[model samples]
Target chain A: MSTPSTSSAPAEAGPRDKHALAAAIARDVPDGAYVNLGIGQPTLVAEHLREGSGVVLHTENGMLNFGPVATGDDVDLDLTNAGKIPVTELPGAAYFHHADSFAMMRGGHLDVCVLGAFQVSANGDLANWHTGAPDAIPAVGGAMDLAIGAEQVWVMMTLFAKDGTAKIVPTCTYPLTGLACVDRVYTDLGTFELAASRGRADGAVVVRDLSGISLEELGGRLDVPVVLG
Target chain B: MSAASILASYADAVADVEDGATVLVGGFGMAGMPVELIDALIEQGAKDLVIVSNNAGNGDTGLAALLAAKRVRKVVCSFPRQSDSWVFDGLYRAGQIELEVVPQGNLAERMRAAGAGIGAFFCPTGVGTPLTEGKETRVIDGRTYALEYPIKGDVALIKAHRADTMGNLVYRKTARNFGPVMATAARTVIAQVSEVVPLGGLDPEVVVTPSIYVDRVVCPTAQES
Candidate 1:
């Protein structure tokens, strides 16, 4: 059927705060690298980044040299980002043809891209946009670009939704933006890496470590099965 | 469905837009933007317009063309990077271009809400800060949130990878950046597509933005700009 369908109720996953997970993923982004910050919690990655890392931030709006958040007198009302807020511009940054900017993305020049995810399958299918809900907003923005354009796609999201369902599923029933595109997943419970395999047989998503939280307690907050390895 | 008019020529596409109008161009830094439409807008001398985009391009290209023409009166985006040129810094110092800056995430949510017909919503992003000043505030769960207004546009300019005659768009990678959302949030949505396909040819599930929200289409020649 043309109509996309999913359960009205959110899947039950463990309780987790997204901000903490976002912070964890931010730690992974190295210094002096070209990065595209996706919308949603991923944008906060810039705020949490360490100073003097020489990280060059690229927004789809056309920017390269941006410093840490604006503070005190540095806040220029006119020098803002695609989001159109006052931001600090670093020295030696240049704006060029936006087509060249996309060329950078499609050309696979970005080092890392942090994106928000709705569902990440065990086999590494990334589906961030379009939940198939009729009531949900019907649009997918730069996510498609960030997913495939960046060399590494790191998804920052909570382990579960408000209804306690695991966003990290075995298979994504919704439309996918990229196949086997995810590199790692950072959730409140801990971090998980999709065990790579030869083909689409669906690899196992193994949680590397837990932060002093029990699996049973964490599983209580999710709708999907959480196997403790 | 009424037969959607195909953009047979670039001149026809440029004619629909006027000078000095509030124009919201889709894309983030530079991905997913319609370079051809931007060129046409520049060629048409549509100056002094309120330009809303994620960020201005590096220099003398993309949205910078409008900025160069001195056609842009104001820019409303989440963040404006300073490395592009000293002119923007001077403009801010001189207050020539008023920049209404919102947090990047909040800006996207506000745009999404505007497109979804939501009047307003509360979020803790800007509460208890200068960003909250002069805006509504509410306390929930012992925490305060700033009441953010929705974002809408008079004209939303977007670029898609492929578009069916029905206007259903399929964006390729980063090019999908704010294109779909900008398409719906604007009073009039204009798109520039690399390829125009038949209606049924595009899979329904793959279509990101439905044709119902689209009003005009501009096809760019393959010649590199």
Candidate 2:
């Protein structure tokens, strides 16, 4: 239970480390975008968002314009993000009821929502909530609402599971969170964009970034056909 | 119409809650939870409760205390699996507690629908997910939406930062989650406020929950040291 000081923090990372990957995603966020960063890896994107980017963070628990995670004596249990981590409120922050908070998502007011996923099919189907293991407790939280609610859904995760299995697959074996809901995915290896939800077909995955791997090598690794962006 | 009664103590606030009542406990985690009120309900010994909240419970306080005491027969919530939710996890794994996991948005909207008197609404949040299985499905404007029904409660236990004697409420930051919505969706709404002001103290523009929706207001923090 020790906090890693600045000196102990990992060396300046390659473009594929989790923080770098988060930065890559934050770089592409349109200015003034209303974004909901999902729990886990997507949460780090908050640190990467440009100052004055006008990116208003929406925590489904009910608050907007939430600032980065709080520390020291600034933590207020009453002021927390969707992740239930105490955070500080930014200027122009507003709080609302849960009903209105979800309404913002369901009504498609969010410009982007980044989520973590177990698997993403080439067709853009998202499977993040459950592993389908019988003993695993199913807790969906707001993943389903965010996946389908935001104008664009981005995923952040490793390209492969701990077992060295590819996470991006021809079809998801896990229980689906939403059908054809993913717009982009940022992984340790590179960034990939799903075909538009409308005209997308099998093997239409587009490669937006590649780190330390050749296009053909990356294509050979994942089940989905990869095209250069 | 008469204003909400300003009850003196937490125990008296939940005195009439019957067993087997579906109680909506407001909170995201521990933020907006009416801890004293729930503790009072426990002391009052209302068992077989169906708890509806954002989270099942955390650690060994508040809602967790209720679950640990085996009072909650079922939990209708969005998320139940958390690091500190051992109380719920143990009950669920033992097949002792029923778990109904709704998407967070739907959980809120369903209660909103109950308060608004809407019968059922179609939502596209979980269209192709397992959560929508066996539910009514309709294709509107070419997109499929699963039909979801309202989730009304017998009692709502919530916490607010301040309340006027008229029961108009204002919340503190994100602790406001579910308090306003739960206020309208329950037959009997009880709120615990840190401070209660005289009538007309809260500005109408900032009153999140009007007095009509809140039946009882308790100042439990006043009784605390």
Candidate 3:
């Protein structure tokens, strides 16, 4: 493995260093799991771990056991994540065939995959790729593999975009990545789960806001009924 | 003769196809291509079909419908977006589907090569990584390149804005995705269009895909939900 920061001590591992949502994700992730953390906000989960736990991180571009973001200038050019960002390779990490990496995804070998989304439907439908907007740059990469291949799908995103628009909606107008693929959704607001109802076997998904946002406040932006807790 | 050799409405034409056929969908992300026809294929219950697209849709719409129905057994795509957790994350966790991910550029080239009747081509994509497994690799210019075979399908589903009676097609804006290349890559090319015009109505220069490749055309259905 490549060593970029051997001099510095590992950052303090605890929940306070992370926000509430990050703490929730750390709580959900199990030990000795093969995990693929999606790019963007999902990558932040790497920064917070339960210290001394074994979580093998896999990057789609052929990397395993990558460390969190850079702490100092100790960078390794050869080792990086899927997004081409410099990442530290943890101990006991080894390089494998890229095909094997995909095989781990395609062959149902992944334990968990944390991702970001634009809109998550009440029925657990995901439509974060194409918004069907006129100028939207359309692309839906590995989202499918991580969506269907992983044993558990956990989403981490803000309740709304920077524009104050709700990222979670009743239905996704954009092109979908998978149907009812979401198992659990985590946001800055609260957590949500898909429940079964009469008509839909998978049932209606309910969003429980923990961020103190009133149900009526979230109801106005979303099309589904909010079961206030 | 294949049904591709005889057809009037692409909507009515694909009824002859049986289940379990492989489909190659063309486009880069949500760029130019036939989206309308994809809906029809789904409604047509083209079950057990192997689908090739850029990426699976995020949720209930687009390519995700097939995934939800469990109709697609294998998916061959290039770029699976990470930002959207809807499809890739969901399916990856359930372990219900098979994925063959190639580099975005290599994916497009392989599709192009298939349509152009090329057996195989070489590129540096997926060489050093795991993408090179069970495949041939060659060195060019002292750099390693993998031999990627052409990707063709039993049925080619495409979407376009306008078409002539002879099957010449035109795309509008980002919809022009993968139109030209995908048209020639399949044994049967089924197209869906918003409008169909007389053969001479379209300008010869603007036609992206010639009528020679298209076998049928269907008007957009309003009830496609």
Q: Which candidate should be chosen as best, given lDDT against the real structure?
A: 2
Q: What's the best-to-worst order under lDDT?
A: 2, 1, 3
| Per-residue alpha-carbon lDDT of candidate 3 for residues A66-174, written as tens digits (9 for 90 to 100) | 7775456756434556554667767777553233455567457888888888887776666655576653334545565566567777788877778987766777766
- Model 3 C-alpha lDDT per residue in residues B21-107, reported as the tens digit of each score: 878775434443355556656677778777877666544555766577677877877655445436655675577767776554455
Query: Candidate 1 residues A69-141, lDDT tens each?
Result: 6788987543445444556767877553343455566558999888888888876678876677643322344
Supply the global lDDT for candidate 3.
Answer: 0.64
Task: Give, for candidate 2 chain B, the lowest lDDT window spanning 10 residues.
Answer: B216-225
B-chain TM-score for every candidate: 0.89, 0.97, 0.86
Which digits, one per residue and each the tens of the lDDT, describe model 2 over residues A3-39?
Answer: 6433223223333788878888888899999999999
- Model 1 ranges off by over 4 Å: A1-229, B1-3, B85-87, B221-225
lDDT of 2 by residue, B149-211 (tens): 999999999999998888889999999999999999999999999998876788899888988
RMSD of 2: 4.0
Ranking by DockQ: 2, 3, 1
Candidate 2 DockQ, CA atoms: 0.85
Per-prediction DockQ: 0.03, 0.85, 0.04
Better of 1 and 3 by lDDT: 1
Which segments of candidate 2 are over 4 A away from where they belong? A1-15, A196-202, B221-225
